[model samples]
Target: MMTSIESTPFKRLDAEGRLLKPAHKAETRRPGRFGFRGEIALTIDPPVTLEAAFATAEDGDAGLSFLAGSLSSYKQLPALVEALGAEVKADGKYFIYVSDLDRASRYQINMGGVPLYVLPIDDTSVYNELIDFLYLDKTKMKKFDTAEKLDVIADGAAKYDQAYEAISYEEGLKRL
Candidate 1:
């Protein structure tokens, strides 16, 4: 025996017991209730990586998701670069590296097309050391000792370049 008018559109009330603005059907949607920004960000793509790896092999640069240690574990190199840039912003422990990527900062060390890798100090020191190897100018054309290692180095290098470009280090840190 109730009319439609009696049914209030406001499903919830305000603190003062007043009718609150009704939510639009669209606004109430939950496309991905558990979605995370970190999970769905623009990252280094694989195809681009393959292409980059072959194209920039001389420089050993590519951006590919890879493991810090085992092949099973993987991480987006771009995200690592972003995190490194953030850390550099918080603490100057690796200011020179971050500054190079930061177009606005001083004391920036332009790689002049050299590859870089800004990864966490993970357990795989070997991997980190290998990446450092790829950064060397002499071995760039040396066909990279290991295929897997080469792929990772290429990815890391790509990230290094990207990270450097995104950040604008505070002026006064550039080296002559």
Candidate 2:
């Protein structure tokens, strides 16, 4: 006779560390007598994604089972991040582009306001490339193409301005 099932309370979070919903019950099955087995069917509101959960964890405390696992087991950060499916960039910084509202909803990532992608900018080229690839093309404003390639130059200046607040290049690289 089973009195109670030992379960881990699972919570959902977005990439920006926002609590998407309250904690839900999740249980792992254990071997039982006479081939009797138990299973847990967990239906997360926004669905459980480690990437979203991790992004949320990075920002602050978000009640997520995987984040809890990563914290409790210090050696699992790399594995945990990998499981989150971080996008790899050629220059630096890990990024996840919120392509559409549907995908954003799945991860609970925001599309407007400040950029939701996480990463650091060191060289101007990398910063320029990132902004150009992600934001510029989506806007109605004119592209910054010029004979002197001034867009890159201007972007470099902006990157420098963000130096104090931006994440270190090495740290961004380590997120992968």
85-169: candidate 2 lDDT, tens digit per residue? 3321122222332211121121111222112233322323332444454444424323422311223322332343222224432
Off by over 4 Å in 2: 1-72, 90-176
Instruction: Give all TM-scores, in the order shown.
Output: 0.19, 0.17
Estimate, for each residue in 75-107, the C-alpha lDDT of model 1 and write its tens digit: 233333442221112111121122122233322
Once fitted onto the true fold, the runs of candidate 1 whose alpha carbons sit more than 4 angstroms away are: 1-107, 111-126, 129-145, 159-176
Best by TM-score: 1
The CA lDDT of each predicted structure is 0.25, 0.25
What's the TM for model 2?
Answer: 0.17
Please count the clashing residue pairs in each candidate, in the order shown: 14, 1
lDDT of 1 at 128: 43
